[model samples]
Target chain A: MTSPPAVRLTALTRRFGEVEAVRGLDLTVDRGEIVAFLGPNGAGKTTTLDCVLGLSQPTSGAVEVLGLPPREAVARGLVAAVMQTGGLLKDLTVGETVRYVGSLFGHADRSSAVLEEAGIADLAGRRVGLCSGGEQQRLRFAIALLSDPALLLLDEPTTGMDVEGRRAFWAAIRRDAARGRTILFATHYLEEADQHADRIVLISHGRVVADGTGAEVRALAGGRSVRATVPGLDETLLGRLRALPTVDRVEARGEQVHVHAGDSDLVARHLLTATDAHDVEITSRNLEDAFLSLTQEAR
Target chain B: MSTPTHPADAYDPAGRTPPRWGGFNRTLLGLELRRMLRNRRTIVFTILLPAGLFLSFGSTGQASDRVGSGNVAAYIMVSMGLYGAALTAAASGAMVAMERSLGWSRQLRLTPLHPAAYVVTKTLVALAIGAIAIVAVNVTGLLQGRPDMPAGTWVACAAVTLVSTLTFAALGVFAGYLVPGENVMQILGPGLALLSFLGGVFIPLDVGSTIWHIAVLTPMYGVAEVARAPLTHELPWYAVVNAVGWLLAFVAGAAWQMSRDTARV
Candidate 1:
């Protein structure tokens, strides 16, 4: 039989006391596929990643990484991760951190190469505490590369990075993917998912809301939101907007009203002519709009 | 991005051998030892404090009074040595609290490192620190040359002191998992000092006295009695029971807390 998918989660559910953080989520990612896990805050992305890393156990359901249990795969050095924050010791220099983790894998000599790949070769002598947030993130990335894992998991790996740093980081990741490494990353930046990921798995409230290519996800969301400053938006106007046959969601924020509908031109015309709306704008949907609409629908 | 030049065969997981010892390599242990030794607090609490206490209090004992195989000064020296080793081991073990707070333990879990291996490594590191404290006190005793003990007795006292201090190392790990990172040593430091006083490590208590009966039950009492056995030539069954019982209890406690720690979100 051919090797199993890089990662597979079947009906994964995790609970924290009374709070059900992850509820019956399912997903599968093939080898060498760059899958982006997209979700809003508190959408169980980190929780799911933790389970895949075996840092936390699933209350129910099965998680497989590299055709084996998560912990087993990890222990075999087939899986590695770059977690979000606070893993580095403040006292050790960057080189020492990389070397120390490398030693755990019996590959201390590879530290310099990984550091160079992570664009932190010059930072070897800098103490982790003294490094900037972006620098620290790069250091974490370097440490993850020490084992040359087959499947890599990154949880918000570039959160604190600068624009240039983010660019360089993705370059390194792309190079790894080209080497047949399966990469799964959880990120808040929709643009990163759109630009880099071959597939996007969007989760909301511990469930997969959408899973496809970026364009496919956007097409699946399939609507534009007409946003305008409405001075007198009341329940009557909201009700009227909700009554529209084409509209999917009607939301109000401060003096602005957002009406999501398939026909944005018709919606914009209705707002400009039929109601007292200013700054009437009709815009095409982007990944952000798609992310918001999909997650909103899940809720 | 540069394309990977190597063929996909290089990515095969089957080609690699799994790490031995559950990722408990000597390199990690070496790094841990260096970090602990570099900590100024470790030096002050483990080495200087014990030696300083021995100098200050041990000097007051009359050199003429003989207790068992050595003079009163030597008995006090052994007691101080045991006290230092226990404190050092416990403090070293509790360093896990800091590692946990830093999320380092979580990171290690993501690696191939087993929880048992982590504990074993930490315990071994603690034992190493305990050895240093014993050596510091014994060397201080040797320089003074007033303890009046045979070379064999000194060797025996140091060895027993180092080995029995493993109880405190286990206790430290248990407390490390029990309390928050910043407060672990704060609570354990005073707690150990109190145990020392109760165990009669710092003072002589009459046999069968009310305090002596309570002392025999304290964790440190047995360790103190056992370490000083070479110098004092007295061995009680109850002291051995106390030492062994606490060791098992602390190890179990540490294991339970470690399981819970790994299961946490």
Candidate 2:
């Protein structure tokens, strides 16, 4: 039989006095699936992650991981997390921090392999306070691996990393995912989610507004836009194009008309034959535009 | 969607599933112990401060002065020993406040380390620091003209001093919860010193005096009186009740604050 999903959140709602941080959030992740939660800041992404990690109790709802409560999974070494920052001992050296966490999880002897995997073996003697932000995040990744956990949760793990450092960090995470570890990360960076996550869940206003693959999420905001140079553009012809089944929206700028076409072929044929239209140009919105369009629509 | 009802509730942090972690992690214990010792401030408070007080107050012409049944040196030694032990223990325990403020405690919560184990480890490490202070003062007393006493008196005084340090260890945690990271130790240091003086840990007070009456109500009064029992050879009834009372009070206060803080996260 297949194993239970790595995580399940059912109608999760969290309210802090007057503010509802998360409202009716439902999500599920099968084992070994690499999922990324994408949202703008204050979109309830952190609140959702906090609920999943059992760090904060929901005002009304539940979060389960690996067929157990978040706390129980956490206690069984089945769950591990690498938070953005501020959860590590500043006074302890890299090696000391890693070793201390290992001992806490009954893995008192896992420093060398995990440290190498996290790419921090050389900085073992450096105190966490002395390490750069990127270096500290790498050390945190090493500590997260001490449990040999089946699932890993990262919250904006590369908030301070430069381009090259972020590439290396994700490379390490990719290797872990290759080993069949279920991975979930929350990030506001659109490119990171598009490139790294297999499945993207876009949250806004404490709710999932879009859930799909990167291509699908892009498709939600993009379609073929046909700009046609139609001579003698009259009100009657423009009205005809606007009502066509293939044309989602139509706009006219002087004699040139722009039509957002769900099917460019149909709109092109209509414009060419049904009217004295010619010189049609087609373009598609990039992911950047799609992201803006989708997020703006949610608001 | 319903919640997962797994059997792993056995690990519910209340000692229900103690076997998983064996109720303690030795590696963590060793690391905490080593880190506490490496701190220069801990060494100063646990060793230098107490030893200095012992030399300055327990020696000189007063060594022959009698209080109750023992000489002045024995009385002052027990009092100074109690101060050092309590200082070391409480100071160590209060470090948790800084850790929490730094978010280190939140990080640990994500691990399989039992929550109760965190408290146990802090208390254990505090006791370890308190032990060093207790030993250092006793040795200072032995070398620096302490009251000559029977073997049982020395052993009992040491035992009381060691055990009574728990009160301060718990009190430190309570204080830690109430204060911020930068001021937890700073505030507790001067506060505990004042409490020591008022509670008669620094000097003997007449039985029926107003200050002594007020002293009996302070936390130090109870533990100090108990530690000095072997030296004075009189275990006052009020002293025993006070020791147990403050121990329970501090423990309850710390546990309550810790639960609230952790939950708030």
Candidate 3:
């Protein structure tokens, strides 16, 4: 039989006072896959990550990392994480911090190697306090690599990085992923989710609204909301337009009829030639718009 | 070119090999102690400050003045040593609070360091610094204070002061987890001073006075009384009970706070 997924959460629920931070989250991360956990603010992304790392206990249900409990997996150095903020000692130099964490996993000399791998070799002597936000993140990444962890979790790891720094960070991550390590990164950056992730899991209101390949999720949030000035708008006309394979929804508003279509090109052509539609405008959906629509659709 | 050998391959993939399993993590403990020693504040509090207190109080006491069988000068030195050692040990342990606020402790929680191991290591390291303070004060007394005391009395007082560090270290760890920010030590400094005074370490309260009755109940009182017992040669049964009682309380508090802090993580 095949082993269980690298990470699993079954009906996981967590509450903070009156707020339900994570509600019945069921997720599985397989080995050797780069998955992006995407969500807007307070969408339970961090909460779920916290549970997977055993930093927070689930209020109900179960969570397992690498076929073991999160704590157990961590103890074996099978799981490692680079959190968004504040898990470092400001007093220690980058090399010292890396050395200290490496030692915790019984890998004393691995720190320098990992620092080089994470592209922070020049920052060895710089104290963590003196490092810039991006530099500190790189240090965190270096420390994460010291464990030779099988499953890596990056929670908004690129939050404070500049455009160039983010690119470099993802490059290092891709290099690691090429070696058959599992990676699950939480990000609000739609471009990163689209470009770097093999699969995208979109969350809204503490529940996953979409989970599929980047292209597939993009399709869920696909469809242009096109509006135009059309004379003699009626239910028969709306029904006819909706009947088109490219159009999912068509509605009449005053003198104008709005059409939501999978392929606006087909809808636009049909509208202009078959019906008296004017002032036709088509706007392509950016990833941001697609993300927002997907989240809103779930609500 | 040969492929690089991964570190995980050094251990069994199942991670049950005794050689690779993380028990107490000695490297982590070594780094923690190394950093603590390099910290200037610990140096001042555990070494320099206590010696200064010893020279100031221990050298000036009248040689003729006596408490029980020991000279008043030796008494003053012992008391100052207790005050310094306890404070330093407690402060050393509570330094974790500042690191916690900076998110270092939470970072540690993600590591393989066991909770029990964390507690034991912290307590021991705190005591180590406390030992430095106790030794510094006693050596000052030996060289500069009135030398009329017996060597046995000297050793006993030093022993008591050194052992009492465990109590303060546990208390420090409790304080570290209880308080939220960098101000834990700043607040604890004054708090410890007040407890020291109330426990009759700085000034002896009259034996029959109401303050003396209440002093014995204070946390510091037991530690002070037990440390001075070697000088007085009048080790009271109640004093041992009091010290044990407070130590138990501090230890329980430290462990409870530790578990509560990490239970969610």
Name the top TM-score candidate. 2
CAPRI docking class of candidate 2: acceptable
What is the C-alpha lDDT profile of model 2 across A1-299, one tens digit per residue?
34567889999999988999899989999766789899888989888888888998999877988778888877777788888879888778899998888887664488999999888899998888899998988888898888777788999988888788788889988877776688899988888898999999888888887888888887777577889899999899899898888678889999999999767778888888888888888887666677677777877
The lowest-lDDT stretch of 10 consecutive residues in candidate 3 chain A is A100-109
User: Each prediction's DockQ?
Assistant: 0.35, 0.38, 0.40
**TM-scores, one per candidate:** 0.88, 0.93, 0.90
Write the residue-wise lDDT of candidate 3 on A87-205 in tens digits: 99887889889888777665446977998888889999888899999999988888888777888999988988989889999998887777767899999989889999999999988
Interface RMSD per candidate: 4.4, 6.7, 5.8
Residue range B1-265, candidate 3, lDDT tens digits: 1124532233233853211434466766787787778888878887787788667766663754878778887887888888888888888778766676677877877778766666677776776777778888878877774745788888888887989978888888789887867667887788988998898887777886999888888889898989989778776677788899999999899878867766645
Q: What are the Cα lDDT values of the candidates?
A: 0.86, 0.83, 0.81
TM-score of chain A of each: 0.81, 0.94, 0.88
Candidate 2 all-Cα RMSD:
4.2
Give the per-residue lDDT digits (tens) of candidate 1, residues B1-265: 2234533445666766667887788788998898889888899987899989888878884864989888988888889888888888888878786788789987787777777788788878888988888889888888887788888998998899989998998898889877867678888889999999999899877899999988888999888888999988998999989889988998889778867776664
Residue by residue across B1-265, what tens digits does model 2's lDDT show?
Answer: 3234432322232332212553368878988998888888889999999999989987677787776666788788878888999998888778887788788988988887777788788888988888889889889988876666666888898888999999998898889889867578888899999999988988777989989889989999999989888878788889899999999999899889888888788
Which clashing pairs does model 2 show? none
Which ten residues in a row are the worst by lDDT in model 2 chain B?
B10-19
What's the lDDT of the predicted structure labeled candidate 3? 0.81
Candidate 2: residue A249 lDDT (0-100): 86
What is residue B38's positional error in candidate 1, in angstroms? 0.5
